[model samples]
Target chain A: MSDARTALYDDHLAFGARMVPFGGFEMPVSYAGILREHDAVRHRAGLFDLSHMAQYHLEGPGVGHWADALTVNDVATMKPGQARYNIFTNDAGGCHDDVLFYRLDENRWLLVVNAGNAAKMWPYLVARADGRRDVKITSGHGSRALVAVQGPLATEIVAQLVDADITVMKYYTCVETHVCGVPAIVARTGYTGEDGFEIFVDSDAASELWRNLFERGSRFGLEPAGLGARDVLRLEAGMPLYGHELDESISPVAGGQRWAVKTRKAAFRGRDAIVAELEADTHDRIAGIVLDGRVPARDGYAVYVGDERVGTVRSGSMAPSVENKNIATVLVTKAASVLGGSLDVEIRGTRHRATVVALPFYKRPTP
Target chain B: MAQPAGLLYSKEHEWLKVEGDTATVGITDYAQNSLGDIVFVELPRIGAALKQHANIGVVESVKAVSDLFTPAGGEVVEVNAALEADPALVNRDAFGDGWLYKIKIDASSMPDALLGPDDYEKLVATS
Candidate 1:
């Protein structure tokens, strides 16, 4: 099948972005350069087209109670205008997807799923919501667009075009407002670990808002960044990517998202399985690794302790934030995940020395 | 841009410039551009013998790792040392300062698959 194109497809091409097929969509992987774009987001601001992510519009009084049962987080207690990270799991405790829930209002919410999981999640939600008369789910996969501005200057650049005083908007909060005269849901959230805003608008108005942001943001050094840079940024920030860090075979507990799993809740999908794994505490878990040299540890590479293979790398990148060292996430045996543990990543048959560090190889400084 | 004149090109997107029996090798501009920012380049050690069309080393961008092939085979005379510190040179000037290595070859036995600048430009254009 031909890949789907986002609303900002032309905008990406205009910026000389290198496009690649991802999650059934033709998305830009990089524009100027991964490292260059990464640097821009770290020091300045970077514009992103995240329209490929599936946005589900949910409404009805039963939405909260319904979602709470399906996800690992407490959706029923979320206040309006709040956003929370959540995960849907299967009976085996494996993740369906790692998603963000934006509570737009008491009876309405927006759930954003990974682009690659849209096909699976849409049907899953439809089947789950079939018998519920009060909850309604609408797929906004192609009709809406999500644009994000991330960096230290993200707020300053986005606040200029937004109608609301986003300067005071707390992180993980959303507001319905006009941006560049277009209706949008402005949320103070991002995956890059930078202070930022994600603007959600109709597909038709996406180009206009993107162009306007670029025209204004360029003056403040806000250049376009693509998925390649986003991967490095999210990895450095220790964010869990759906496919790599949390997949159908990897549960939230094993994926290092134990904090998001609220066992205190009455019941949820995969609760028993996840709780079992949590109590067992013997499952392989995700760990942070920094290579000793310049050689990059790629996904699927074996991680070893002397002669015994202990794990496999899940996501790897040449981190620009962590002093230009190579950083990776590896799902490893419990013993191999100890902080400061010495491990070796076997790349192309040779073992490279590495140190197991804490999650979030790079953390943004508090303002 | 047209492929630099007088250089022979390989289908793998590498260029070979023959200076008598010593030939300089590097990836074509198209390869570098497609690979994005090159962060590391693993080149064959000096004195290593390589076969034509064989994987000799690797070129790594931030997102990917691509095998570097030897367009023409022989004994590796010298590998670019500067790339150890600055692999982005391959992205900056792939044909000039970014030349990956020099191989001591039998000029008369150069592979027949090498294309001229014109053919290379066509190859890149279609690619």
Candidate 2:
């Protein structure tokens, strides 16, 4: 509870935002209202302060080999200025953390780690530096703050605001450009399943950039979204949250992150254990459910089938923008993983019935 | 911030409008404004008896769930069924169309506990 607050504390107080502790930081859960901010990200764009996340730059020869062995994604083939969402797993195939790897050039890469486990992932990567004479490890340096602007109109609004030409940056790509006179890097990757960009800049200048974004994007219905809306939006997008879906205790095979696992090549840290688990048929799987009604089957609620308890819901919400129903991701036993399996969430001393459904309760219209 | 001239509000933010033996109870305009979105409203059944400041129902927002307590003791005469189907009405109109329930109140205890408009406004300003 005594964790140091961020630089945006004053801004949050001025905006009358309700602050709550998350990942040990006093972060805003909502401002201007939850549904109002939620709809803004879904319909327009949202400005999220991602300053809590940790970033690092890796350089020198054979960095690709180090990255390829460190993460579950195919980072060796990443072209210069390209970014790929990746996952790092333990020897038991359990994910240590999920990260985004950005290729700066040959033998140089930038990685963004989760807030809580940023320091934890650093040692894991450093220990696996494949035959490197020197590997630079810098965590939380130079106020490497980031802002995620996500929605259908995010690109258009950001392009209008930043001096950089953000038009040509393809999805999962990064470009070193000046945004609003601040030297920054804009990456076309985000948690919400929409056309968006994540901008990285200095901390002292981030608030100004954020204020500028809101001022310019106000005409397009942009709102300052908080962690509350961010959670629901990511859930609706079926994107796996770090603590909910990936943690040190849960293996990637069970966390529904096999797409990021590259087991076809030489063995990585978690490759052996992942192969063994994939061959076996005992591990639990993550499943999505759209509850029968608007009442959410929140975190830690039980998931059941008639008289049998099968799983527990990790993250859930009654989506605000569209589908306005309770949707949750559940860690279910293998037998209860079927789509038609019925379930119920015990909320407020009442059991609300639900049904197992497909993922991505919401997605942007294809352009 | 609007506190109707005639209505009495509770410290917990519930408002009551007494008309003869019946009292209409709902959260105040300030309460709804602070709560952001009203996603689900769970109201008590008609004919249920309740005590003053007792838990009558629950309201679920996207962020959290809050318990709803009544300001005065009464027997539920009628519950707002429209709110159960569309809870957003509470956000759109917290006082008029969003009135939660109508209770035939115990007329004797009604006048002493409720806060007047000026008092409720001052209470919230300090909070």
True contacts kept of each: 0.87, 0.80
Docking category for candidate 1?
A: high
User: Which has the greatest DockQ?
Assistant: 1
- Could you tell me the TM-score of chain B in model 1? 0.96
Question: How well does candidate 1 reproduce the true complex, by DockQ?
Answer: 0.87
- What's the i-RMS of each model? 0.7, 1.2
Error in Å for residue A27 of model 2: 2.9
TM-score of chain A, every prediction, order shown:
0.99, 0.94
Q: Second chain only: TM-score per model?
A: 0.96, 0.94
lDDT of 2 at A22: 70
Candidate 1 wrongly placed segments (more than 4 Å): none
Q: What's model 2's overall lDDT? A: 0.81
- List model 1 lDDT by residue over A1-367, tens digit each: 9999999999999999889999989999999888889999999999999999999999999999999898898898999999999999998889999999999998999999999999999999999999888899999999999999999999889998999899999999999999999899999999998999999999999999999999999999999999999999999999999888899889998999989999999899899999898888999999999999999999999999999999999999889899999999999999999999999999998999999999989999998
Q: What is the DockQ of candidate 2?
A: 0.65
Clash-forming residue pairs, model 2: none
Worst 10 residues of 1 chain A by lDDT: A273-282
> Candidate 2 chain B: worst 10 consecutive residues by lDDT?
B105-114
